[model samples]
Target: MTIIRSRDFTGGRPWAALDIASMNGIGTRLHWTDQPYIWHINEGQEVFVVLGGRVRMRYRKDGVEQAVVLAVGDIFYAEIGCEHLAEPLGEARVLVVEAVGSL
Candidate 1:
């Protein structure tokens, strides 16, 4: 059993992560970042949960770009093939669940 204090979590570099679990080809991880993630579509669904700090969730729908500011406790769901990116407003901690090796 493990108890993680999300507010206190950090990593060595931007977008660094601590892998939490993997099962049936799915993966869960805790990530710390102070920069934006690349815009790309995932091979599978993704669940992004903000554990601390803030983020600007960016995405495109029907070729139209859209975004929203996400704060602690906010959740972003990315369906497979959805083009998206996560730009951290500052040093932020997030929990992500998706398929292993997905981009």
Candidate 2:
């Protein structure tokens, strides 16, 4: 059993992650960041959960760009082929579940 205190977690740099587990080609990771991630499409589906601080999630839908602010405990699910980016509001910790090696 793995127990993590998300609030106390830190990374070496923005978007650095601690790998948690991988199951059936899917990987679960804990990430820490104080910077914005680039817009990209995931080869597979993605589940993003905010564990600490806040993040502004940006995505494109049907050629239109949209954004939402996600606070702690908020969850964001991205379908396959979804193009998105995450911008942290200061320091934040997030749990991400996605296909292994997906970007």
Best by lDDT: 2
Tens-digit lDDT track of model 1 for 14-59: 9999899999999999999999999999999999999999999999
Writing each residue's lDDT as its tens digit, candidate 2 over 5-95 gives 8888999999999999999999999999999999999999999999999999999999999999999999999999889999999999999
Candidate 1 ranges beyond 4 A from true positions: none
Range of the 10 consecutive residues with the lowest summed lDDT in candidate 1? 4-13
Query: Clashing residue pairs in candidate 2, if any?
Result: none
| TM-scores for candidates 1 onward, in order | 0.96, 0.98
Q: Which candidate is the best by TM-score?
A: 2
Poorest 10 consecutive residues by lDDT, candidate 2? 2-11
- Backbone clash total for model 1 is 0
